[model samples]
Target: MIRYRFGQDDVLRTRFAIAPLMELIGAFYVLRRPERYVVHRRWLKWAASRVGDLDLTLLDAAAPFGGPYWPVFVSPPPREPHATIEAELSRVRETPPERVLAEITHRYPDRLPAAARPFAGDPAGALGELVEQMRALWDAVLGPRWVTISALLESEIASRARSLAALGSRAAFADLHPSVSWEAGCLSVRPTSKSATDVNLAGRGLLLIPSAFTWPTVWPRIDPPWDPALVYPPTGIGDIWEPADTDHGALKSLIGCRRARILQELDRPAATLELAARMRVSAGGISDHLSVLRRAGLVTRRREGRRVVYARTLTGDALCRPST
Candidate 1:
């Protein structure tokens, strides 16, 4: 069992973040283990043809053998809540050669994946090549759908943040994943493998990262020189590929199809343009619908920075709640 010993400071220092590249890496697992991730079967079938002949042996090798030691340079914890893929890739590019070599050698001392072996001779060049390939893979497979994916991730973070505030850390961690448990100030993660491990936060704290792709299990990154983190599947991943639940027939009967969907989609606050993209409607039309909903006391609008975000009110929530 992995134990994360947290001091008072560690508890205060804990934070949450969303990682785009981490999702890309997690997608590799989904591709390899479709049976384990049945919700993503459609995505798996679609992604299979798009991934082409890209090499993922290095990522595969990084998976837990006796221990989980993913190359830190590749999947470092995010510095902020909303880090861009470009910025994270830059960090990977700037990773010192020695660090890369150390991680590679430590993970595969004798035999290495064919894709990672070349890094031993020229860590800088080979690692750079790997990063480029990762970028291409992201563009081809995930970039197009990042909007919907990121929205789902952000919604999960917001919900967890609320839980942390209202119910405290223990309740928050308890709800993170089935394999995850917190007791006596230590957070334990039981992954799919039979191996049991212990990780101590040592007052360094932890980063809770919500990922759309890392479903069915919670993945831990406890290697040294990197802030410890728990990467777990976020809620609502099943809806990522499925169509929006616009079949709110009762809701449609009351508010019309477009407005009912707008209400359904507002489970999380979103701006007009984002709503437009998700609903496949024009900004002007969404604005009109939001105006009506706001007037009817079904939705409210607030400015988040320069954008006007809309969210359903309590009355709206009651209306949208599924009938028992």
Candidate 2:
């Protein structure tokens, strides 16, 4: 059990972010243990053939026996909503040499992998190589589908934020993962490992990160040099690997093909531009369809900053739900 004690300031400062490189690293775990992430088995098989040449020596050693410190260097917590892979890699490149050596030693107290031993002497040079390999792996495995992946992640964040607002922090944390709980002034995480741990926010706050690949469990990073953070699987990850299913013939007949397809896609709320890009239709066309759906009481639009996002209503949900 890991407990994070939150001070008054810490509670106010708690923020959420999306980490792309973290998803890439979690995908590696899915590749190694498909049974643990069966929902992503299809993606694992597909990514395996494509990332054959990418070197994952560092990542492999980092998680030896399921530890957290090593992967933190590769996928450090993001400070903002729009963090890019390039920016995260730059931070990894600048990590102090001593920190790298310390984490490697901690992860492999007995014997370290040959690929990682060279880093003890020259951490900077070794990290540069690791970054290049990670970039290549990202391009091969995740870059093409990042648009869809990021949208899913963003939607999860928005949902959690709503939960935080409507249901309060404790309820929101409980909903994040089955292993998470809130008690007293501390947030606790019960991970699969036997090691029991405790953390104090100390007014630094916690960063809640939503991940597409880190399913079936929540991961915590509590060590120094990185902010305290939790990485939990998002709500709609089951649909990430599966192709969009919008071929409900009956519904299609009722609403017409295009609008029915649009309604079907609203299983999750999305912005006009995002729907447009996914459907390969112009934004204007999607807007017209959304307007019609809104009028018919099948969909509703809510203003989120500059974008007006659309989501299926309860009435629309009944229409889209598979009939018995």
Candidate 3:
């Protein structure tokens, strides 16, 4: 059990952010143990195909399977919400050489593993290589899907913010996850760590991060030189990987077949060109349909970097339900 004692300052300082590097790390872990994370099976299948030819030897060794902890410098907590992947990777590259050696030693106190020898021998050289591998993974496997993933994470934060306003912090924390609890000015998390740990939030507030790949568990950071953070699975994450149901004949009839097909394709937030390619329709036609759907309150649109993605709203989701 990990307990975090919150002072008056701590409560005021608590904030939320979306960490791209952390999400990438979580996705890599899912790849390592796909059987354990059945919820991400669909995503695993897609990602596996994309990275089949790429060499990930270093990343695999850095984040080995079944370990209670990985190196902290590999993925330090994000300082702000909406941090770009480039910015996060830059931070990892700038980690002090001493910190790298210290973390490597701590992770392997008895005998250094053969794969981790490079870090112990030459921290600077090894770190540069590691960062290159991580960057390649991002470009090949995660960069394309980042927009959709970011939208899902943003939606979770918006929903939680509403809850915080209406029900207060205690209620928000309680609903965060089954393994978390709060009482008497303390927040407790039952993490995968076997040891018991306690932390006082001193003055720096807690950073709450919502993650799609961190499903089925919550992670906490309580080390020095960094603000405390908690990463937990977000609501409606099960649907993040599920493909759109293509057999919505009834829906197709109510809204013209083309519009209905467009709505169905938005199972996980997609852009105009993507929808056009999947449905084999012109991009202009798809945009016209999306505009009508958006105005009708069935779908909503948002810009993610250079692309504008669309997703079904609550009413839109309800309309997709198959009639009895």
Candidate 4:
């Protein structure tokens, strides 16, 4: 049971952000325990072969299966709302040797495991090698699907924003998760790890991160020198890997099969790359369909960072929604 006491500043400072590395870490967890993540069965099927090719020896050691203490340097809290993998990896690469040693010591108070010896002996060199492995993992596995995953995470953040706007903090976070509760001036989170401790935000405020792979559990970061953070499964997990709607038969008849799929996927805003990947089509092909949808007022495009994402307009939504 970890309790976080939030002051006025803490409440004001609390903000939401997406962490790419954190999602990568969550993927590791999924790879380690596929049975626990039934929601990702589809993804697991697709990623199994891809994941098997990589030598995750060190990465596995860093986030060993069934452990309450993984080294913190592997996946640090994201400082930006829309963090990129490149930026996050750089942070891991820059972690001080002492910091790495401290975290390893904390995780293994008895004797350092053989796998962790490299980190203790040469944190910098080990970290560099670890970062390279992480890059390979990203490029081969997570990078391709990051677009859809990111769009899903962004949708969750938008929903949270609306809830915060409409219901204020208290009510908005009332049902963050069964393990979480907001009462009085403290936010209590019951993580699987039994580390009973209290944290005062002072002013750094908690970082609320929504992750696709952190489903069925919430991970809390209470260690010092890093801002308090809560990484939990976002809403809409069951449908994450499931086809938007295989029963879009009527919609398909109305608008060709290809266009129907593109529209259906637009339930959450997605960039051309994501649309192309999901539909197994080319970027140019998706762009053509999106242009048609945009002109028809069925979808709208807006720039988010370096990418432009498309979301369904009301007409598109109504069209996709089933009629009683």
Candidate 5:
């Protein structure tokens, strides 16, 4: 990587600096609000210890969906957000993604030089292709207003870019050779930490997915073995509460495969190796599905050192009409 005098590298450098700054600020923010973290930590500790998705599901069921974080209903996390570890996902259902991207580019020129940089070469083409794909995704789920989705969309992309730049490919996200994305409303994030050198890439399964498009948006991917229908219609304050039965049309379209089926199997909860063994597949296979499910809001991932555990969502339990 060649460094230009205040060129793309500088832009990446600034982003790297800012993400940690926000993270640090957020950490301090939580520390200052120790009570919030404490209350959440206590509950999360319980949830984490509980083995199956049923127990965790009960917690989500017990708690009001939007009590602590409202943005999730507006823009759910890449994974389920219980009382602990909340992330902001703004709703832009009323704005156009193209327009939003324009506004963002207009606002932060240095941070986003992609818009200003002249289109040329493969990188330029790849970036353009990625943007176009995001635009399509925004349109598919959000329709016209998805144009505003570009801001949040680009935020994810830029954040990843910065993380990779700062952390280095190995120290950064694991799925390096191939990138992740959401195609035709199907999430496409991949987690890979296959190390080639001294890089201690945890490869805790890279997830480029987020938490906004849970069921109603992604049920099409669930299969019998993976997600045995067990849920109740979600009747919350901000979401499409007690909505109609599952949209069979959409689900039918979501082509479930080995990975999708395994996710359905773990609709409860399982460790990395357990899920892999039960599904008769590779750990990476389960990790991939978990990453996608977590991103789609169907599953959740929590960390314990180098290993991050996985489980299904309670709201989804309601959707599946789980008996117990």
Candidate 6:
């Protein structure tokens, strides 16, 4: 999905997402997952500058905030926004999927992770990898612990829509983004894409990535908004953006770590060293991969004071569909 659009009032929209962003950096954040966290921060930084210019253009030249484009959300109705949006899009009529995708691709690179766009030469293959990479990214994010946070935030934002969905109304956002919905009694948010500009980044791979802008991407059916506005950084900020591809090849496990198989092997929570023994990997190596998985939302870690324990998240459990 690698969708690059978001609602104007996304719940996670932070004016200063930079600080929390800094916390998740380094090996603990990077190698754990592949492109997601890797690309997200760059997008955020680039997009930050873009938003100021976009808002200035919109609020000043395009039209007033109250015109057709600006829809208010002061206690809006459940599922109403999504449904209304569908109708509005219908009013615009169906544009060619290729054109729609192209416009998004052209606009998104600056606002999204540079990895999102497929490498120039192999656009199709790059797009497929991008989508799949993005989906993998979602699997890591929107999982259990995240679901708890998502639920809390949804309650704060989409209290009514969530309530109505429970009572049965189309697809709930939870169904699309399992991690965000992994928690019981949590509210799910579907994408409205209002005020959110679309960037195709071209959905080439799997996992239904909702936005490349947000790392550990998402799997919302309606593609919930993450960033408030489409951000575009000025050129020469870094490397010239290229469409993402597995050109360098998939990342190697940090020596002796096969955390996925280890997690797959476990039936219960296990100590790092214990799983390390089972996986035949060195304790240090297991620790490193566990750290990676932990960041990827694949596995989780908790300190029993001196010792740390790792386990799979509900999203992981669902994904693994482990035998009971």
Best by lDDT: 4
Report lDDT per candidate. Answer: 0.76, 0.77, 0.80, 0.82, 0.33, 0.34
Best first by TM-score, ranked: 4, 3, 2, 1, 5, 6
Predicted structure 1, TM vs. truth: 0.71
TM-scores for all predictions: 0.71, 0.72, 0.76, 0.77, 0.25, 0.23
Clashes of each: 5, 0, 0, 0, 27, 16
How would you encode candidate 3's per-residue C-alpha lDDT over 9-116 as one tens digit per residue?
887778889998888888888887889899888778778877777667666666665566677888887877778788899999999889988888787788887888
The residue ranges of model 6 lying beyond 4 angstroms of the native Cα positions read: 1-257
State which candidate, 1 or 3, has the greater TM-score. Answer: 3
The number of clashing residue pairs in model 4 is: 0
Model 6, span 1-324: residue lDDT tens: 123332333322212111111111211233333354444344334333433322121112111112222111111112221122223223222333353344334544345333333333344444344333333332333222232222222222343245333643223333333233312322333233334433432221111212222333232222222322211111121321222232111222422326556656443557888987787779897777777777776665555547666666543444443221
TM-score winner, 1 or 2: 2
lDDT digits (tens) for residues 76-109 of candidate 2: 6676675767777788788787878887787777
When summed lDDT is taken over every stretch of 10 residues in candidate 6, the lowest stretch is 15-24
**Model 1 residue 75 distance off true place after TM-score fit, in angstroms:** 1.0
- Model 6 per-residue lDDT at 36: 44
| Candidate 4: Cα lDDT at 260 | 92
The per-prediction CA RMSD against the true structure, in angstroms, equals 6.4, 6.3, 4.9, 5.5, 22.6, 18.6
Order of models, best lDDT first: 4, 3, 2, 1, 6, 5
